[model samples]
Target: MKSRLNVVFTCFLLLPSMVFAEAQSRPRAVDDFFANREILATVYFTVGSAQLNRAGEQVLDKLVPEIEQLDPDVHLVRIEGVHPRKDHDRMTELAMLRAKTILEYLHHRLTVPVDLTLTGSSPSPEVRRAGRSQHRADIVVYDNLFDPHTADTNEALSR
Candidate 1:
């Protein structure tokens, strides 16, 4: 009886995780967030400048509707800025500043609380680039569109 009870309890504990995993793996509500229903896009900038040019600004403008539709409880927006192969520290700072600028634009212009994060590469050119792809940024955005809760949980467990 004791062994049987343990097995039943274990199954019960695992069931919710399995169900939630399945639900998270499926595509989510994006149409409510964007006019075109695409929840994500990347904006590129010149190698040394964090400034958004006319085209970058246009893309950001296009995302206003999606930012407005984000569900605070269910979704999170992460912004990352990258620098090409160069001074990592300076580039990281610039990227973070750029991310903040974008967040402010989203908040004031689009009425969305855009969460921003900055990342920098600490690796050598060999590790960082695929030379064929001319595009490179020292910073980038890490998206957490699905399973953020589980990710947080896993992070905690690792610690």
Candidate 2:
């Protein structure tokens, strides 16, 4: 009788976790998060500047609306900066700064909080050429429409 009672008590305690695990394993929300990945905005900068130009500002302005619509808790944002220069280090630094500038502007303009990350890359040619593509940052937003029925059980279980 005592053993049976203990088993019953254990099951009662484990029920919630078991249910949570099942929900997390369903993967519909995860699928949507992955499926909705694309670059939403691309902001360009001038040579030797980490600041936003008029065109960059205009582009970011349009991006604000898209950012506002995302669920803060469910989405992921990545700003990838690409700057090309003769000096690799200089280009990488500029790229990273440009990305940060974009991130700050978006955060300032929107109430939606996001999981944002910054990445920088530099493609430098030994001799300078007309490569305007070097000074640009791509802002990617993942439209993670979460499944309300399923919680983030994987994280809970790991904890």
Candidate 3:
């Protein structure tokens, strides 16, 4: 009877540590908090002209309202331009122009200030062979919901 009582006491003492070990092994709530959500929109331009075609205007018209409806968690917007030819200087200039035009359009529509990244032309043959698809700009939005420092503090408080 004394040995059985000792076993029970030992298990009672170890139970909390076992529970804590299990909790430590599991993923933190903060790890699942922030998610990367993206919305992609492409605007195609003429071969050599930086002018926005009718289709491009239509794309922006549809895209602006959708972007405006995005959650506050969205923090970044990346605009990448892909050109047909491999002339670095010309492609870079055109890419900047395309990104700037789209930025101006979005700036007027969105209330939140977004972090923007502009990437120059992609030198891939696949993009070039896609015909009209080559002269295009791609806009991507990223959602970042949680701040790590804040999450850490909250976790400590919960403990």
Compare the candidates by lDDT and give the number of the best one.
Answer: 2
Instruction: Give the higher-TM-score candidate: 1 or 2.
Output: 2
What tens digits encode model 3's per-residue C-alpha lDDT throughout 41-158?
Answer: 9888877667777888788878776666655443556676666664455765676577667777767766666556665455455545655477778887654435334346665456
lDDT of each: 0.50, 0.69, 0.61
lDDT of 3: 0.61
Comparing 2 and 3 on lDDT, the stronger one: 2
Candidate 2 Cα outliers beyond 4 Å, as residue runs = 1-36, 85-87, 123-132, 143-159
TM-score of each predicted structure versus truth: 0.50, 0.58, 0.57
Model 1 lDDT tens row, 8-95: 5445434433544566463333322222222265666666666667776777888778766766445556554444443445654555
Runs in model 1 lying further than 4 Å from the true structure: 1-39, 112-128, 131-159
After TM-score superposition, what is the CA distance of residue 158 in candidate 1 from its true location, in Å?
A: 11
Going through the candidates in order, what is the number of backbone clashes in each? 10, 0, 0
Q: Report lDDT (Cα) of residue 47, candidate 1.
A: 64
Candidate with maximal TM-score = 2
Order by TM-score, highest first:
2, 3, 1
